[model samples]
Target: MKRTLLAASLALLTGSAFAGTTLDLGYKAHTSSTKDDNGGAYDQPFVKITHFNKADWGTLLAYLKLENPGEIADAQHGKDGKLTVKNLMIIDKQIGDSAYNWWLQNFLVSNRTVMEDNLYLGLTTNRKFDKLFINAGAGLNYSAAHFDPTGASFDGISGGAVVINAIYPMQAFNLKHRLSVNYEGQFARDDEHKSTLGYDSYGHQIITTLKTSLTDTVYTKLHLTHFDSWGSSPNDGIEYGVAIGFNF
Candidate 1:
């Protein structure tokens, strides 16, 4: 299923250098099949707003995300790792048609009224060749968790995927489409109240999307995302969603 989706998406990037600003709002519902028995089929609704435009100074881009958990068995499922919001800021410099972008992101996750914040910094260089576009970059992240007990907290530092993304836009099967893929593997360290919980953690994710314009201002996207986190503790992932969006 994953490979089929990826191949179909790549088929869209044939020969293009068109760029524009886009905004997306959507939700995904999936069944979880992790090693842990604590998992359940959950429908997560998300609202995302993104802005990207070319400016005299550079190309500026920004995004805001909000996620809601519809149901849960555990409070962690109900309220844990719930109530999350993230924001990203990006600046890009163009040389010819290709560009280099630097970005920073802030993430907040709330569980049972306890909130945690994480920050990440990243840099990427991208090139557009005819109908194919590629991007690569690496980033570092730091996370701080706050607890209500007044004396318990967790902190962590991690390096995230220096990844490559290839996109192909509109040109096959009489349907306009766009396909994108990316990967990441990183090492992490965690400390609680300055005490080591573990010194090993790693994560990886892959997402493939297919999009077509229904009209001049409206588009639809079929996306499938799979993620894995393995090491001392692991978080396996699942996501599949069909989203309809409007573009300006």
Candidate 2:
């Protein structure tokens, strides 16, 4: 009896391992309504690649994404124009059949021109019940922002986020749509120890996207976003974009 039970347990574990490995690659492009704020968003594109494999201890997740952003300049919004690099990873395991989840991510972002880098580590998980899926996670990010305005240099700000997401499927079109929202805030305190230029800033970002299938491997998407900041000198704004995507 004891031998039979042990054999059954091993078989179940082996089967679960084979069920969870997946690989995917995707690309997206966006064009802004006005070329003034940001250069002609004509070829603005982002590419992502991801892989997940079951491991002896847990799951191994790896991903990489790169973006060539157009120049964005507005007197009130500051100046943003640089190539960006982003990397992410996650590893987690199954607790029970219904609650198999992972321990968030190890992520990094870098600005090529300024030589500034930002890093973040966090935990994320998802749960499914019936036809509904719920997911949430949070993490802290640290990075330095240099004020290369010729006379002063300031470097002291931390970023963090809170997220909530859900998805439902409609039987009619055999489509599954997901809705996710995340609130991210950043705070910076002058570390230069200069009182005259000493300043702190806070800001929040919110995003929403809708996705549906157009064919067996084709898909469509719509995105909306809002960002607001408040402090000594602050700016707030909103933006929306829509596009169709293909999977190959």
Candidate whose TM-score is highest: 1
Per-model tally of clashing residue pairs = 7, 1
TM-score of 2: 0.54
TM-score to native of every candidate shown? 0.68, 0.54
| lDDT, residue 239, candidate 2 | 47
lDDT of 1 by residue, 1-248 (tens): 21222232343233222234455667775544632422422456667776654444345557776656343223325644354555655554544544666745455655443455656677777676886777666778776766554546677674454566777776576666777675545545353522322224656567788777665566778888776642112356667887776665
For lDDT, the strongest prediction is: 1
CA displacement after TM-score superposition, residue 124 of candidate 1 (Å)? 2.0
Worst 10 residues of 1 by lDDT: 1-10
- For model 2, the stretches where C-alpha displacement exceeds 4 angstroms are 1-82, 90-107, 111-118, 122-125, 147-160, 171-176, 185-201, 229-234
Residue 50 alpha-carbon offset, candidate 1, angstroms? 1.4
| Candidate 1 local Cα displacement, residue 189, angstroms | 3.5
Off by over 4 Å in 1: 1-25, 35-41, 69-83, 93-116, 146-152, 190-200, 230-234
- The per-model lDDT (C-alpha) reads 0.55, 0.45
